[model samples]
Target: MNAQTLSVPAAIRARRTVRHYRPDPVPAELLDELLDLATQAPSAWNMQDRSIVVVSSETGRKALSEAAFGQPQPLEAPVVLVFVAETAAWEAANTDISAQATGSGAWNEQFTAMFESRAEFHSLRDRGLIRENAVKNAMIAATYVMLAATSLGLASAPMNGWDPELVKQAIGIADRDDLAITVMVTIGYTDAPPPHPGRRPRERTVHTELYAG
Candidate 1:
């Protein structure tokens, strides 16, 4: 943990969409710890169907910024984490997932067998559904990385606007159709930042038992 680590709530409160950044390089050891914590984000069936490409080189950052429609955040931040959704990862790792689940007693062998064979499970295995779930997993992991960055006395900015095709080509995955670029998060230090924009009212966004319009 960083010496100046903040609590979860404080981190959330302190986080903002920072674009400009100081040129100081983020320590590799700190970045590794941040990723170790980021990847701890939960995934569907613990499939962990996501991969991150850390862009630190000047050329890589320039390419990513171009992919992100010339967004300055990617171009300026010391590091940009490209979150990728590996749609085919789950298909090839089911056996391993089931074995681990059963091994850990999280799922019994018989239940794992039945779960894989059930019609309900089959319904969720379509290509589109699988892709959507994979992207969701990637987004969760990105959020974890962003929050982790803030907690570690670092700044981050999540960039959602980008050309996926361009991103794939930028990151050297143009040939892999099974992988999708879900999101990008820039991590670095900032000198000055504007105030948090603040969130919408809880009553307007959150709802109990049943959602109310």
Candidate 2:
């Protein structure tokens, strides 16, 4: 329940990317729970503007593999979750609240009127602070999902090596600009041993007083 009480070290050690799976399906309930756990991640102003597209079908996996530079692991894993950072949702919420307080029901319409287009909506993404928060929120949510999967005895890999626009288009989402792909996570059991070789020694990665002090 509390950060201090969490046994994260054990979870960190157990969590790994398993490329080989036994073709077993992840239970729907467990998948739902894992997604719920991911939302527990903190977001800017509690916006929580993140969405997930679960790709479980063979066709979906094939498309994802293509989007991910033809990586075969997406096809091997039972599930591939595409984490999306929804900037439009946050923009719409802020616009609605501002309009309600100012007694204007047609807020976005008014914005379109002034800009002579839908340019104002795109302005929301131009703001560096909002963009930064959007990315941070999405990444934190993905971390939660990975940790939850580990706790559930499932292996996962957080991926960012993909074409965002292509992946968004492949997923068939209408609002392409609004939702930006942040990461992908493959979930399943592993046949190979955990690849613990890549990790840095604890002493090298951690510090006590100060680095080079």
Candidate 3:
């Protein structure tokens, strides 16, 4: 089905955390489109410090499954997308944040010069904050992928049950100190629909005005 046919609300309601998938392989072009859609998710200062590893080969999938402590979803699905956050993206100073802002006409030369100082402050004084920001932005992109996949008539499962060190080694990014493994997503078609565990009511989770503790 085309994206125009599936409304965002419909896709959100229909999405399920699929655990089992048919052996059918996802098309390369379709996966590319999905990835493109995912990158559209907003990031801090438009740094977009996220990277994805697409594991479609049997060997890669097996390695990822092993790293994930034998979780069968990675093995069962035709494609496993691994999201990573490059924590050191801010180190680039002008390239990561300033260039995007200037190119998009969102900032002028004066603002670009101003942002460089702010970026330096974060890199030097708020390293931990930068890392946290990267992980948060990456997770948002991963969520976008799941919803976009559902819209395109595919099933997805967002997995967090995995060894980060082993996952990095399995995906051959263990040497990169700046990259943090965020989440793994299994994508493919599912025949048996899993039962939906209903969500909690809004009042139970959302707090109005001042959070009444």
Clashing pairs in 2: none
lDDT of 2 by residue, 93-211 (tens): 35443445346553465643543343533565566555556777889988988888887767788878888777887688745766778888998777664667676678877888888
Per-residue accuracy of model 1 over 1-213 as CA lDDT, tens digit each: 577898899888888889999998999889999999988899977778899999999999999999988889887899999999998775553677778788899997777866566443246675348788889999999998988898898899999999999999989999999999999999999999768778889899999999996
Ranking by TM-score: 1, 3, 2
Evaluation by TM-score, superior candidate among 1 and 2: 1
All models, RMSD in angstroms: 2.0, 7.5, 2.2
Once fitted onto the true fold, the runs of candidate 1 whose alpha carbons sit more than 4 angstroms away are: 114-121
Q: Which ten residues in a row have the lowest lDDT in candidate 2?
A: 112-121
Candidate 3 achieves a global lDDT of: 0.86
Q: Per model, how many backbone clashes are there?
A: 0, 0, 0
The Cα error of candidate 2 at residue 174, in Å, is: 6.0
CA-lDDT, candidates in order = 0.87, 0.74, 0.86
Candidate 1 TM-score over all chains jointly: 0.91
